[model samples]
Target chain A: MNFSRVIYNKFLSSWMRISITVIILIPFAIGIALLLKSLPIIRSDSIFNLVGSGKWAPSEGKFGFRPYILSSVYVTLFSFLFAAPVSFLSAIYLTQFARGRLIKLVYPVIDILAGIPSVIYGVWGVLVIVPFISGFVAPVFNTSSSGFTILAGGIVLAVMCIPYMLNMLLEVLKTVPTGLKEATLSLGATNWETTKHVVLRNCFSGVVSSFGLGITKAFGETLAVMMVVGNTVHISFNPLQSGYPLPALIANNYGEMLSIPLYDSALMFAALLLMTIILVINLFFRFLMYRAVNQ
Target chain B: MRKRKNIEEKFFKSLSGLTTYSLIGILLFIIAVVFYKGFNALSFEMIFKPPEGGYYYGGEGGVLNAIAGSVYIAFGATLIAVFIGIPAALFINIYLNRMKKVQNLFRYLLDALWGIPSIVYGAFGFTLMLFMGLNASLLAGIITVSILITPIVVRTFDDVLCNIPKGLIEASFALGSTKTETAFKILIKQGFSGFITALLLSFGRGIGDAASVLFTAGYTDLIPRNLDEPAATLPLAIFFQLSSPIPVVRERAYAAATVLTIIILSISLVARYISGRNTFSNIK
Candidate 1:
C-alpha cells in the first residue's frame, strides 16, 4: 500500500511537470501553425512585392499589403497622438496628487473601462464618433466623410487604449521610490519641477515600454477598428480617408475566401504578418525593459 | 522666482486634473450612448425569445440564442482554462520555487502570450481545426477561447501565488507534507479567492472577445445543442447586426452591446468584491 501511494505521488508530480511543458510550448505552436498556413502565399509571391506593393487584387493573384500596413501604422500613430497626453497626465494626477478615496474611485472606473468589450466600443464608435466626425469635425476641416475614416478608428482606439496605458503609467509612477521624492521635496523644489526631473527620469523605460505595448495593441485590434475604419483597400495618408488595416483585411475577407483561388492563403498571410509584427514588437520592448531593470 | 514657480505648479496641477476628469467624462459618455440607443429598442421579448423569421430584417425576436451561446462557450472555455492554468501556476510557484531563472522565464513567456492578439488565436485555432479535420462549432470555439484566456488565468493566479510568504511553505514542509500535498492542501486553500477572481476575469474576457472566435466559432441563429453545433456569441451578434443597412437591426445591435457591457461590468464588480473581502484571514 505504501509503495502504491509513493508511485501515485510520483505520477501526479510528473503530470504537473508535463502540463507546464505543454503550457510553455503554446506560443511556439501558434507561431509554427500560422507560418505553415501562410506558406502558400509566401512561396507564390516575391517577399518584397508582397509587402511593398500597394495593389491588392487577390483575384488576379496579387496580394500586396503596403496599403494595409501603412493604414495600420497611421491609425496607430493617430491613436498615440490622441491618447498619450490624456493617459500621461492622468497617471501624474493619480500618483502625485490624488488622495486615497479619489484613487480608489478612479481605479475601478479604469478597470470597468478596460473590461468593456472591444465590440461595444465599435458599436459606440458607429453610433457616436462616426457621425460626430463626418458631421462636425469633417465640416470644420473642409472635408466630407462617411464618418468611417482612419481618424474615427483612431479616436475609438485611443479611448480603448487609454485605460491600459493609464494603468501601466500609474504603476510606473508608484514604483518611484518614495525616498527620492521626499528628498526632492526637502530641497524645496516645486511639485512640477520634481515630477519633471525625478519621477519622469526614473520611469522613462517604463513609459516607453507602455507606449510600445499600446502601439502593438492598436496595430492588432480587428473587429472594432474593422467596423469603423471603412475597410477601403486604398493607400492614402489622409486621416479622413477610408483605409484597410491588416487585421481588418483578414477579418473582412474571411467570408469570401472560399470563392477565389489563393484568397484563403492571402488572408492567412495577413494574419501571419500581423502575428509576426506584434510578437516582434513585444519581444523588443520586453528586452528593453529587462535591460533597464538590470541596469 | 518664487511667484513664477507657484504659477507653474498651479498650471500643471490643473492640467493634470483636467485630463483625469475628462477621461472619466468620456467613460460616462460611452456608457450613456450605448444604454440610450439600446433601451429604445430593448424589450422583454428581446431578452427572452430567440429570433423569429425575418429577424435580421427587423424581425421579432430576442437574441436568446446569442445570449445563451455566449454563456455556454465562455463557461466551457473558462473551465478548461482553470483546469490547465491552476496546475501550471501551482507547479511554477510551488515545485519550481527555488529556480528564480526558470520562474522568471516562465513569467515572461506567459506575459508575451497574454499580449498576442486574440485574432491571431482565432486564425491559429482555425488552422488547428483544419488540421484536425474538425469544423467550426461550439467545441472549436471553446478550444480557441481557452487558448486565448489560459495565459490570463495563469498570470493572474501567479501574481497571487508569488505573494505567498515563504514561511508558510517552510512550515508546511516542517509538518512532513510533500510538495504536492502542500500545494493542493495549503496553497490552494489560501489562494482560493485569487483563483476565483482569476476565473471570473478570464470568463469576462472570453465572453467579451469577438476577434478570437470570429473564425473558429461559426454563427447560428439557434442555440447550439451540442459541442458540434455552431454557436453565436453576443459580440459577434453585435458586430453582424450593426453592419446591417436596416435601422431596426442596428438598434438590436445596440441592445446586444448594452447587455455585453453590463455582464462584463458586473463580473468586474464581483471580482473586486471577492478580492476585497479577503477570505482566509484566519489562516495567518
Candidate 2:
C-alpha cells in the first residue's frame, strides 16, 4: 500500500509538472511564432527605416510604423489621462462613501459595462461620439474635422477603461485596512481627509499598478479604436486629426496579406511590435504589484 | 484653514458622487440605445433564420449564421481552455503550493498572457494557420480563441483555488490521501462552483471577442457544418453591418449588438450569482 501511494504521488506530481511546462511555454511559442513570421520583414528592412519612417506605401515596399506607433501612444495616453481621474474618484465613492446597497447596485452596472464587447462600444462611438465630436467639439475650435479623431477614440476608450480601472482600484482600496481608516477618523480627520491621507496613501502602489494595467489595456484595444479613429496613416500630433494605430494597421491589412509582396510580413511585424510593447508593460506592472505586496 | 479644508472635502466628495452617478447613467444610456434601435430591427425571423439573399444589402435573412458560429466557436474554445486551464491552475495552487517563486513566475507569465490584445492573437493565429496549411475555418478560430482566453480562465480559476482554505487540504493529506486523490476528490469538489464561474466568464469573453477571430475565422453567410468550414461571429457581423453605407444595415448591426450584449450580460449574471453563492457555502 505504501509503495502504491508513493508511485501515485510521483505520477500525479509529474503530470501536474507537465501541465505547468505547457502553460509556461505558451507565451514563448506565441512570441517565437510571431518573430519567425515577421522575420522576413525584419530582415528585408532596416529596423530604423521600419520604425522611424512614416511612409506606409505597401505598393512601394515601404513599411514605416512611425505614424501608427505614435497614434497608438497618443490615443492610449489620452484615454488614460481622461479615465484615471474619473475611475479613481468613482472607485473612492463606491468603496468609501457609498452605502452597502448602493455599492451592491453599482457592481452589476460595472460588470455590465465591462462585459459589453468592444464592437458595441465602437457602434455607440460611431452613432453618438463621432457626430458629437465633428459637429460640436470640432466646430467650437473652428476646425473642420471628420470627427474620427484621436479624441473620439480616446473618449470611447476612456469609457471602456473606466469600469476596468475602477474595478481594480476598488479592490486595491478595499485592501487598505479598515482599522487604518478608523484610526484616522478617530483622530478627528474628516472623511475626505482620511481618504486622501490614509486610504490613498496606503494604496498608492496599487493605484499606480492599476493605472499601468489600464494603460496596457488601452494600448492593446483594436476594434473600437479602429472604428472611431480615422484610419489615416499620418504622423499627426493633433488629437482632432485622424491617425492610424499599430493594431489597426494589422487588423486592416491582414485580410489583404497576399496582395503585396511583403504585406504579410509587414502586418506580422506590426503584431510583433504590439505584442512586445504589451509584454513590457505587463512585466513592469507585475513587478510593481509584486514589490508592493511583498512590502 | 479649517474652513478651507472642509470646503475642499465637500468639493471632492460631490465630484466623486457626480462621477459615480454619471458612470451608471452612461451604462443605462448605452443599453437604452442598443435596445431601442435593436428591438425595432429585431424580429423572430432575424433571430431564427439564417441570412437570405442580399442580407448585407438590407435583404431578407437574419444573423443566425453569425449567432450559431459564435456559439460553436465560444463553446469549443471554452472547452479547450477549461481542459488546459483548470489543470494548470490546479497545478499552480495545489502541487506547487510550497514553491512561492515558481508560483509567482507562473503567475507573472499568465498575467503577461492575459494582457496581450486579441488583435495580436488574431495575427498570431493567422500565421499559425498559414504555417499549418489551414485556411481560416472554425477549427482555426477555436484554436485561436482558446489560446487567447486560456490565460483568463487559468488566472480566474487560480484566484478561486488560491482562496480555498488551507485547512481542508491539510486535513485531506492528514487522512493519508495521496496527492492525486486529494486534488481530484477534495480540491475539485471544493472549487467546483468556482470552476463553473470561470468557465462561464471565459466563455463569455470568447463569444464576444471580435479581434482574435477576425483573420482566423473567415466569415461565412451560412453556419459552418464542419471544423474546416469558415464561421461568422456576432461581433464581426455587427462590425461589418455597421460599416455598411445603408441605414438598414446599420440598424441590423444594432440588433446584432443587442443580441450579443444580452448573451454576455446573462453569462456575467450567472457567473456572479454562482460566485456569490459560493462565498456563503465556503468554510471560513
Estimate the TM-score of every prediction.
Answer: 0.97, 0.96
- Per-model chain B TM-scores are 0.96, 0.97
Q: List, residue by residue over B181-203, the lDDT tens digit for candidate 1.
A: 78888888888888989999999
Estimate candidate 1's alpha-carbon lDDT, on a 0 to 1 scale.
0.87
For candidate 2, lDDT tens digit of each residue in A181-294?
Answer: 889989988889999898888878988999999999999999999999999866658889997888888888876788899889888889999999999988998788776655
Q: List model 1 lDDT by residue over A1-295, tens digit each.
A: 3777678678767877877888899999998988887788889988788999988787898888998999999999999999889999988888787777777778778988988889988988998999999999999999899999999999999998999888767766767788999899899998788899999999899888878887888889888899899998666678999888888888877788879888887888888888889989987886666545445
- Docking tier of model 2: it is medium
* Top candidate, metric DockQ: 2
Candidate 2 overall Cα lDDT vs. reference?
0.88
Clashes of 2: 0
lDDT of each: 0.87, 0.88
Error of 2 at A200 (Å): 2.6
**Residue runs of model 1 more than 4 Å from their true location after superposition:** A1-8, A290-295, B279-284
Name model 2 segments beyond 4 Å from true. Answer: A2-15, B280-284
